[model samples]
Target chain A: MRWKLIIDPVGRPGRDNMGLDSALLRSVQEGGPGSGGDAFLRLYRWDPSCLSFGRNEPATSRYDVEKIRALGLDTVRRPTGGRAVWHDAELTYAVAAPCHAFGSLRQTYLAIHQMLAGAFERLGVTTTLASRRSGRAPRPSAGACFALSAGGEIVVDDRKLVGSAQVRIGKAFLQHGSVLLENGQDVVSGVTMGTIPRVCATSLGEVLGRSIAFEEVARAIALEVRERWSGSWSEESRSPETIESDKFGDVSWTWRR
Target chain B: MSNIPDELRYTEEHEYVRSESDGVVTIGITDYAQGELGDIVYVDLPDVGTEVAKMDVFGTIEAVKAVSELFSPLTGEVVDINTALDGNPSLINQHPYEDGWMIKLRVQNLATIEELMSATDYAQHIGE
Candidate 1:
């Protein structure tokens, strides 16, 4: 199956990125699997450094509204379930495909993370997948995606590097993740009320002893996806601005929880 | 292996429905469903009196890794919801069939239950 690679070179607002991910998921769900409908790999960046909480996360309790307002950062709620993520100096990737492409939820997560790990390896960074420890619990109070590494997340030397989440509906699924390009963990921890465990977070710039361009990392990951999935890539012409206007930009969606 | 109660009917989506008095039925995810979901953090169910069609998404179950839509097994109106879940969403993971019951629906068509798989068939479906 040939997958469509949508590379948005321009940085967009948080709402538009979320909206585009949903649009891609809907396209696959309506098109069905193996019906000449292309799966999508979207690589994007966020402007003004937005903070996104999970669909079910209680942001009201975990974040201080006054502090968030003072920081002048954009905020939105993710359709996927997970903790909060601070999007700044990062490469955000979203993969929308037929659910059957990966048999179970866990399998789908591992598949994408593994592909990411391969891409990181190609870029000269060695990382491993986190093991699922039985009976481990998430501290919702922590209020940061990199505070803890869940099972199948990519980590370098026990420090989390990539945080991912998924939203599955009917026949299709969308899994999006954040790959930190620089050490922005302190900024994330300072804004949220909770004490984010900073020891577990790491970034590419910190690992490589120099800054990396967003385009360079995106190209490497895209190359890995092409080699791993055995598919061709093409750019999608239609903009997801319509979906942004209709859904993600709406206040109701950002604070629905 | 997950538990599959013989008295309840099941959907391929892993939702289970138990018939009640006067065309009403109780709905929740099966043991297999909850087990797969893994420590549900939140359950978003429709309020009482909302109408739903068969196979339509009625709600969502948010786990640590994913948020999955909950599909209604039969066309019906939500008559009751487990409000306790607002404070303690883990009930679904702890007791999927009993304390974790999601909602009660006044079924629109009693014959719709016939379309669901029998408990034995559901056990086979999950490879129990």
Candidate 2:
């Protein structure tokens, strides 16, 4: 349950952020368990409001790319799998570790969200996981992540507040996603090609009836991880890997699916 | 419990190798892997004729919760792939050993198949 904590005080571009996360996953994959550390947790935000697609998400045909570019939004495909998420007015968290450290994929997803729900409760906001009982899995046509809650997403009264995706490389894995502090789902809805498109998500600020800063939510989440796992947190920083950014910038990589 | 057919060989990573001829073998994820991965959504396999190194990642399997890498069990060339998986990946969950088979590799050395785990050893490897 030991982990490293990274908080990026200033917002960075989407490519740089994605690059660092991808690089961390590769490092953990190549280094194996207990090389640099067992796990890493990075809380960051995007500059100029980027829109990210999942690793294998059908973005080429499903998204309105011309409109996205015209609206002046940065775009990149995530190393993880899921759907689209608009990376603005939200706190993004990236975690990379050996696959066994988090157990299986579903177990890891559930465990992380459960901790997040606990974190939100500490911040005076109640959260629940959207499961089969809570809602239906999003139809294939659901383009934006927040448009529908998948089984393990964190939701507040049926509105998704956090959307995360995970990818495994050999023995290591990286899971990263957005925790909205403000409702930015509308922008995602507008850039998609779904016929009856609309964003069905809420934000921490909306739930708490007041705006919140990234630091406030970050502190609560960090405290939750420490208290629940009986773990210590070592601080880290983002250092871009050129190979990762170069791959991200390549058009073929973005439309790789 | 997960199925581990006695006729097939296995890798620690959960890929199963089934011989079809002197120099060719079929490959797929074991039933235990499909069970652990849950509902399958997509599979990305290398194109036919692609040379794959032993233990190298040859593709990825995207289940509902995450994307997992698929490693080659033997050094070979991809002779065939399951095109049906492109349209319906859940076949892996419903029938992991039969119709869900992922690829057919033309092995460089047929004897290498014996180096993999037998069903008994695989059963123990998974701590069954």
Candidate 1 lDDT, tens digit per residue, A1-257? 56888788788888888988888888788884432677888888999788888887877777777888887879888889888888999999999999978778888899899999999998899999988757735634446778877778899988999989899999899999999998676766776675546647899988888999898898898889888886677766445444533576776777665
Cα-based lDDT at residue A174, candidate 1: 96
User: Compared with the true structure, what per-residue lDDT tens digits does model 2 show for residues A148-218?
Assistant: 76677899889889988888888888988899999977887787775746678999999999999999999
Candidate 2: lDDT over CA atoms?
A: 0.83
Model 1: how far residue A244 lies from native, Å: 2.8
In TM-score terms, candidate 2 sits at 0.91
Best by TM-score: 1
Cand. 1 Cα-lDDT = 0.84
**DockQ of candidate 1?**
0.58
True contacts kept of each: 0.59, 0.51
Which 10 consecutive residues of model 1 chain A have the lowest summed lDDT?
A237-246
TM-score of chain B of 1: 0.98
Clashing pairs in 2: none
Candidate 2, CAPRI quality class derived from DockQ: acceptable
Candidate 1, position B1, lDDT? 89
